[model samples]
Target: MNITVKFFSSLMEYLPRSVEGNAMAVQVDPGTSPRQILARYRVPDEEVRTVMRNGVFLPEEDRDQPLEEGDVLTVWPSIQGG
Candidate 1:
């Protein structure tokens, strides 16, 4: 299955070189979920501060929420300040 992924802040560096800004498309198994995708993409769990599935916030406990075709996933990394 194919889905859209948008990473925020420092997470953008994990994206492909050709990926612009913080968004890109990726392929995954039919039953892949937000957390699974992150792991599959090698994104650190700590860096995944937020998750939005199709414009809705996806709770950590709900990581197994089924991903459908054309789903849009937005990932925001935790922000820190001195």
Candidate 2:
């Protein structure tokens, strides 16, 4: 299965290939969970502050949501206070 990932802030710099924009396409196994996807990318669990599936916010408990082909998952890290 494949999913679209959109990163924000410092996360973009960690990507292997520099994406001018804030998103990329990644391939995952069928029935992949959000936690599994992030782990594959080596993204620290704490760094992921927000999780969205196809433009909808998902609760932490729902991180196990199974991904489908062409699903887009956007992750945003929390910004610290000024």
Q: Rate residue 30 of model 2 by lDDT.
A: 94
lDDT scores of the candidates, listed in order: 0.86, 0.84
* TM value for model 1: 0.86
Residue runs of model 2 more than 4 Å from their true location after superposition = 79-82
Q: Where's the lowest-lDDT run of ten residues in candidate 2?
A: 11-20
For model 2, residues 1-69, the per-residue Cα lDDT tens digits are 778988888777656675668888888889998878888779998888888999898789999878899
Question: Which candidate wins on lDDT?
Answer: 1
Worst 10 residues of 1 by lDDT: 32-41
RMSD of each: 2.6, 2.5
Q: Residue 70 of model 1: what lDDT?
A: 91
lDDT of 1 by residue, 1-82 (tens): 9999888888888787888788888888898888888887799888788899999988999988779989999988875689
